[model samples]
Target chain A: MTEKKVYNVAIVGATGAVGQKIMKILEEKEFPINKLKLLSSINSAGKELVFNGKTIIVEEAKPESFEGIDIALFSAGGSVSKQLAPEAVKRGAVVVDNTSAYRMAENVPLVVPEVNNEDIQKHNGIIANPNCSTIQMVAGLKPIKDAYGLSRIIVSTYQAVSGAGVNAVNELENQSQQFLNNEELEANILPVKGDKKHYPIAFNALPQIDVFQDNGYTFEEMKMINETKKIMHDPELSVIATCVRLPFFTSHAESVYIEVDKEGVTVEDVWKELRNAEGIILEDDPSTQSYPTPLSAANKEEVFVGRVRKDLDNDKGFHLWIVSDNLLKGAAWNTVQIAQSLIKNNWLQG
Target chain B: MTEKKVYNVAIVGATGAVGQKIMKILEEKEFPINKLKLLSSINSAGKELVFNGKTIIVEEAKPESFEGIDIALFSAGGSVSKQLAPEAVKRGAVVVDNTSAYRMAENVPLVVPEVNNEDIQKHNGIIANPNCSTIQMVAGLKPIKDAYGLSRIIVSTYQAVSGAGVNAVNELENQSQQFLNNEELEANILPVKGDKKHYPIAFNALPQIDVFQDNGYTFEEMKMINETKKIMHDPELSVIATCVRLPFFTSHAESVYIEVDKEGVTVEDVWKELRNAEGIILEDDPSTQSYPTPLSAANKEEVFVGRVRKDLDNDKGFHLWIVSDNLLKGAAWNTVQIAQSLIKNNWLQG
Candidate 1:
């Protein structure tokens, strides 16, 4: 193997929750980086974050911020990414965006390294990360698709409030306290912060995650629907999603029903494939009361799947329960994996 | 129509969560009650419960507690129901059990009132109540089963901890606080209190509810499997369940995948049936962001269902999301409905 050369790395939105996780993941992976740059909004420019025993000061993100930066990771917000991503690309930095800005764009490569690593080479300056729910579903289903072709997916998600950003997390805490104390709750940032009305998420479930689309599906649900087709590269594939926010802090759980193309596939057959697949940890053992849970999957990098079984009547239908830390595999780690793929494939320099 | 005569009613396990809700339902429905007796364990005896502007003192439940009682409602544990239910029946009372003691017994009719109200007339002195999860599933599916035959059912439940009793609710609150403050959490009553190991349910999901059975299904899952057959009166129907306890307090949400025996049935067909079905409120308007959530259904009596769709590839398959207050429709309201049926049908006479 050729000797590795260190490259300059830049993280846009370096002060947010997913941004913080990206910083920690970069340190944990010990990525070969000659220099690190942290960029955020002007209001948060003076904030300090320590990484690799060095205090890094955050700076305002602008086109000039990408000078000499080989890789740019963006997670601030969709609008921020829409404004700064192309600008960073114009400065010769490859962008791995963690927002919906370019995910469905015809030109952007929506990637999950383990599922579609080769798709990274086709990126035109920017690569899109799939939604957290979409990422875990595709990761678990990819192997199944490879073993037996997939035709349909019906998913109901039990999502964490952290996916709405840090403010919603605080709102869950505050509203939960108010509910416990029998005090009136003030709701500002649940369901969708920009939506017309707010619903309390403390000890409750909100069927709406993002804003509602014209089709009656929430933006979050549509993201899973569209992103699954894009990531799996099967527009003909049928998918329906109902995303609900629960009172959890970290991991997202999904009840997924899938129809495979092959016939006579048994639960044993699916379990065998999952046990041997990469980046997947199968914890399904009904005898030992073993299965994946949000708390157990939190802070873990692997996609945990359990409660797998074949449909009782349909020979080809199957059900799975998939869980993963939304911030890690869903956002930060997936972004870093794409960056690593870019470096390995020599796509970053272009 | 002949005049309806008021009958005596008794509530076992009074002062408990479900027992309190039963009292509320009875008061709201203004059920014909010439006398109301409240019975509880010795520890809760002498407690005063206010219903309809009258204070009823809780008496200690015993084998002789049902003497002179006409209609007896039991929400106590299975062991307590096993010991006292037959005694109540022997003393000229019609016992409606909300426990699992005689649910699958040969002679006892497991009733949902809406689904199998006529089956209540076949009860040999005692009528068994189905599991909370099973009750909601059967209620939603019974209508569909009547219009279109059901071949198989696969459900994954997002259950509330309050189903485990009051202590589990307290444990969830305490653990949530400990988790938020980064303090060490101690789980004492979740994932089956009698089991050797306990897992924290706050900010977590426990895959196992109740204890495990010989067939690798938890007792809760087995209850759903066996009870669905008993209530639907279709032993040939295949049912599988994965019961999970979430941090929520009262409502239970289930993702149900079913295969219909008839072909070419669209989602609208099932929706039409549910829209006119009694005891079911169809809250499924996706465009305006209207769907049944646990918070909205927490204190409600109806089983709320939405997100109904047909499987894209399978002509016989469909998916539905069912949500209901476990403490109400799943327990208390169902018990009260049975009581009303008893008096209306004149089955209360010994």
Candidate 2:
């Protein structure tokens, strides 16, 4: 066979934490690329990023920046994606957006390559990357859904501050120091930066992760509710989420309670499926005191799940502990994986 | 009411974080103490502790040290309590043990004053303070349990590092700085110091809190499980615990799912009982985004409960979020409160 032609790639918001992770993943994956364009906000533009030993200048992201690019990875803020994602799509580039912009959109396909790669073929130019929390939950639940059929899911997330943004990461650091020194703590970031009050996260747990929606659920909670149904393609699946931001910086831990449709599914059966599933590393041996911790999964790409047990009274009910790096499996790496899937399936040529 | 005779009180583990807090609480509550005696291990003995504008020399703890003491608050360590609590009791001192030594003993009354103050009178010689996670959970559930009988509880705790000991608190501070400086993290104190391996807790979550038991629960988890039954005085009550140590230094937050014996108990009813309950702050307003956070409750003595909601499909199922400073309501404050209750009820004899 003749050598495959390399495609041009553009990274939106290349200066951001998730954007930088996307760039690193692309290089590590050795994605086929003829031209690599790095784009960022006006404030971050003109900065040079060295990727794969090549110096690339980050230009201001705009509608014109996507010209002649085959794939655009968007990890910028939601507002930036909302403004330029459609423009990039109009310029004949397929967009893998890492924000919550088009995740619930009717036309955009929210794809997790391992769970819903078939959905990518139906995307109308823009593919939405599921929320970091939602992605890991679905990644772990997809195999169970296929085998036993899920009826209800209730998830309470122990999310990291990095999910809010890079500034939040900095806020956690400063507040931690103030707490240790017995100095006055000044909180400016956690439990929704735009919210009226800020609380110190250094020695605390905040039940709210994002701004509250009209439905009494935070935006992050709503994201998990809506995205779970969309990713599973089951509009009738019952899902509820309570998202909390802990002082953790990277990985997100979730206490997930699920009710499977089929009866007689034991904990061992679920463990067998999860252990054999792709992109899942089952770190669940309670006997030997083995389970996934956010610390152990901080830099890892695989979703680690443990603490699997059947609900005491309900035969069909089960509880699972899921943990993964919110930045990796939840955002940047998933975006890059979608791009890889698109190329492997020849869906980008449309 | 002949001038309400003040008793002499001694506090062991005077150099620990819980000891410091106990001193503060004793001062704030204006405990009827004619003399405040501070004691510690030989290593920390001779250190001066300031309380109520006076510095007291911390003497080495021994059976002879409690000769004239009326009440002794012991939080040194389980081993120390196992060795010295009985000795102090034999010397005519009523001991409030904060360690796990006498918590589950048939004769040692485990008391959370707000939940079971009447049980304090049954103490043989020593009273046991419940686990921090268990204290908050029982405090929040006591009012509900009084109003509506309880059936089962499943709790997943997001605990702070201070519960592990002062060294864990210092480790969290140092590791947090290392994370901010982009340096490799060092671990020595988390997930039980005596465990074979240690993990970083700066920006991470550890699934194991205390050491593991044969039944797959950590010792901390078992404490929550066993202490809940003892404190609630319902040994038949089913409880499961998954204790996790987050990077936080003070407050412990728990996601508690409970099945009430009575059906159709609305969230409003639960809120009503909690709002009017003693030593509990009901913070369940979901409209103004008002809820209890660990930061707000860190230094406060009250147990904060919020996010009260009924499970969607189960009429008897309810979920509540509980937060409290483990060092305070969980240990030191609880011990002090027990001592006060004993005196108030004439259970202490000098």
Candidate 3:
């Protein structure tokens, strides 16, 4: 096993919905792939897909499809990751970028491989990923902001419609079968499919997700208040969000609140730091109504947290709920766990 | 105009869903009734119900069905509004109630005729009504808490499924056609059809909206934090709800946030006091993706303020969204505007 170095990946919106959930989570995490590719655009190339059990096809990406490509990922849109994520980091590839194109870029490391896997060795080769409602709300409040010390968050989300992709999940299944057949439901795409208005997410909610900013928030609420202070490095904390769009089709829930910074934090001290955190899943109890819902955290991939309490009057506030699976742990298992933490910490050359 | 005195109302859950939207908003606000009883329960009593064009008949709610009811209303469940709203207020009928039995009953007032219609002249005979997600979030934050003295109110909601009534709106339309025919959904009722589990709001998002209280919150998040501080008379304000239950069927959006104790204020000064308050309908602009959603404030009847903005780092916070029709202005147009402010302030002999 010491000789197992596999690599080559590539996905780039290969028939999206988070690029077919990053090719079914890289064939259910049997990822040490030596060559998988896929790519997309030009009308979803030829479209074949499959993965672990063979058949690839998808093609058309170009910039010489990242020559040999050692791990690309990218969920396709912010102008196709601002034109092929630096041409797949100038051919040696190492992208990860699931859209808001290089998430607040300053050397691109918005990551959430469970709250900053050491910001993946400070990635300069593009490792962004963060916003599927800020990747399950900072991966369910990064272990209650690393054992009580957060200062303020305030979220609200409840998102879904497959994070507005796959044609807003076929326009929420054709406006929920035209609102259960009473008809008239059609609305071109969603709260933000290239904005200029389009509502009716079937039963409805739409507080407008992406597209609005010039101060009034909603570029998915300033990408969950600037990718949660750039992945919790906490730029003077206090965030804000609000991003709605409900009529679900895959998890996103949220409701957050936070305030911590100690001073007797409780809810059993944020459930003992979300039961010793790590891709969290607490599912609070409220005496067995248990918790976590967006269809029981649909297609689960962790980060469920639940109705944690404490804030009848802010003894440093609390309130949680966070959920997940916005296409698996919000966007193809946090972009294949930051491409499996850049191939098991060998941090793939920037 | 001086001959306008008709009364004799009644309607206790006139066949549910906020008593059929309080009989289609008392037949579209032609409320000067004279005898429109239609009560229910005892297996939806005869169920005729047509209203303005006549038919009527629901009947069964006894204790002499509030005899010559000068104005009743109740809304059936909460042990039939704590047994026919005190026998329709010992036969004189000022009631109003729409359940959660006498909301926090300190001699009951809870009303939200645009946030405390002078607490309906200190009602001693039940006026209650407040939680259909706390009457459109304290009637869209009572004109930004009378222009900016609010303090705090978090909220979250997104509720609907007819605020959990017509069998949780037929279990969200038979679990959304058994999740659009992939089958196997069947949840009996919802986030709380008398709690103890039953998720699947078809497409999902039920952060338990009621039942679960011994301090973990949810009795619809402590009825939107003890009825928005007893209809904003402010018991040191600072509210905090989180109720959820989405996969809608008719309005109840929320998202709220607020903070306000004066200071600089401006999101156009909370949109010019939500464009001069009363029954608010601001629908914030955000360059035209305008706001207010839950299916564009479903059946309408007011409160639909929009994404008001302002909290970029808490300039006294802000961030609204609201929306109405959780059965018209959250439960039959604020219980027929507190029965038209207890019959145009004659106070209905409370």
Candidate 4:
């Protein structure tokens, strides 16, 4: 048997929701790793995490933590990624950041592997993972855009609570339990954790996702609009988005309306392209009630697309429902995929 | 003191979700009624419902039951409306129908009092109340359309389970309790209860709001499309809808995208129109994190419009967040409003 080359891997924010998912996914994928290190804030120091039957002790992340690391996956808050990602890069480690810190930076590559993996080669020692909702969306729509060309896009997301990180998930669970028990529902960590106000997500939907921008669109909406154009390399695709946080705990689902550039693409044509696309599973049999729900798509790494129908009024418009596990496909798996793509294609350089 | 004139009133399907709301609204409005007649299907016959501290038995609906009813509100079902509305009209009752039976019938006026109260004058005995989702939407959009001519509309609804009926509400409660208990959920009523498949709606969303039409659009979607055009009196205006059944038990919320004929309309312009529009409550301050969720809009008589913003890409297009108690403003209150309009305007020729 030919020996496979391995490299040293480290995970920043080792105790977070997405960070933990990254650890499990890396193990499940059995990525070629010679050594594994876990790093977090000093508050999490001495805490241990398991990877491939070995207990790895977490140390405080700093400039020295990435000295010999080949690749570091980051899922800490934006501030942590902003402070440490450059440090990691300076010490010869390529970073796949899962925060909004570097996504829109001119030199950084905001990549969804299925949509814009080639952009990874243009990175300056760091590749930014797109937002959880944006990741599955670009992946689902890229095949259609490639097959039939594209004109405009409008998306409304039914996002999961886990996208807001660990405390938000706990808030949802706690609020749900309170709601069922007829107790007072608390709202301390939702809509936007640092915003001026908080709202309960138990049995309710909030239209604001992230903080409101001066122009009235939420930051999450702007991230979707900007990142999609960047990943697709279309500066003028006329993209619009409404991001709403639902009560779901796992997967993020989107209702997408797309107007193809080509005039005569039918629903079957889109279906054919989706079925042949990688990292996509077409679940669209209306007769059999085969479509993706958050529960059905939970813990899965593939983007599930369904409800493919041509617009009743417009010949060029099509509607679709796309769903995926926000933690797996949206954050952790995509982060690991970027690392895998870099290693396999020999595109990593620091 | 001069005596006020009182008319005999009847409520068809008096035990139904919408009908119960109508009964309560009539009492709250202090409608001038000499006698109240409650009618329902034989399945619910002999059920005594209290209104204004008086018990009224729900009799099986018969054609002769409308003998002296000056204004009859019908919400039983489409077939029941088709059979009984005309008979009520023959017996000198002006029917404000809450079903889809006579909605598209020629000479039958579809009225959302805030949108087109004048349409009630053209009614030949039966004035059709628009669909629940459609009523709230048109009521919310009418002011904007009146101030700036509307060219196109596309709406996606986050509709509640109660819009399906009372049994769907029970299913949601039962399924939610079952979900909380870690037991398997049973879904017998949702997303068109008579359909072959029964998917749980406890913590999930079902995209199929009604049975699928041959054109791939659900009937509920078609209703919103057709009813919007009809109530707005603009057959040439393009309208499209995607209705999804959510887990909430009360209000139906909509994300509406509109393209206007007039250009340069700002978010402030839309807000000004909504603030002054009748039957619409503007709840749109991002600073305060104010917007209508289903829970916030439940049991309210007015439609709530918020999150108003101009589309970033389309200059003439705008987005709106509209919510309302589907049973109140969407059905019962609208029905009572139509009856009030008839009485005030002397439009009930029958």
Best by TM-score: 4
Could you give candidate 3's per-residue lDDT for residues B1-350 as a string of tens digits? 57878988888777767778778877877888888888787787886878777797787888987878888888777887886688778887888787787788798888787777887888877888877888878887887778668888888887887777778888888888888888899887677776676767888887777688788887778878877888888889988888887888888888888888988878887888888887787988889888777776777788878888888776787878888888887888888888888888898886
lDDT of 4 at B58: 90
- Regions more than 4 Å wrong, model 1: A1-3, A261-269, B1-4, B46-57, B144-152, B236-238, B257-272, B308-319
Task: List RMSD in Å for every model shown.
Answer: 2.8, 3.0, 19.4, 1.4
Error of 4 at B194 (Å): 0.8
> Predicted chain A of model 1: TM-score relative to the true chain A?
0.98
User: lDDT by residue for model 4 over A1-350, one digit each (tens)?
Assistant: 99999999989998988889888988889999999999999999899888999999999999899999999999888999999999999999999999999999999999998998899999899999999889999999999999988888888888888888889988987887887778999999998888998888887888999999888889999999999999999998888888888876788888888899898889899999999999999999877767888888988999999889898778999989899999999999999999999999998882
- What are the runs in model 4 whose C-alpha is more than 4 Å off? none
True contacts kept of each: 0.52, 0.48, 0.90, 0.48
Q: Ten consecutive residues with minimal summed lDDT in candidate 1 chain B? A: B341-350
Task: For model 2 chain B, give the 10-residue run with minimal summed lDDT.
Answer: B212-221
Query: Which candidate has the top score in lDDT?
Result: 4
Better of 3 and 4 by TM-score: 4
Provide chain B TM-scores across all predictions. Answer: 0.97, 0.98, 0.37, 0.98
Q: Write the per-residue lDDT of candidate 2 for residues B1-350, one digit (tens) a residue.
A: 47868998989898888889999999999999899999999999889888899989999998899998899999898999999999989988999999999999998889999998988888878999988889999998999999999998878888888888889988988988887778999998777888777888888888888887765557887898788898888988988777788887778898888889998898888989998999999887766778888777878989999988777557887878899888899888888889888888798852
> Which digits, one per residue and each the tens of the lDDT, describe model 3 over residues A78-184?
89789878988888888888878678978888888788888778887888888788888888888877776888888888888887787888889888987888889
Ranking by lDDT: 4, 1, 2, 3
Clash counts for all predictions: 0, 0, 1, 0
DockQ of each: 0.50, 0.43, 0.35, 0.64
> What tens digits encode model 2's per-residue C-alpha lDDT throughout A256-311?
88889999998889988997899999988756668898878888899999888777
> Residue A157 of candidate 2: its Cα lDDT?
83
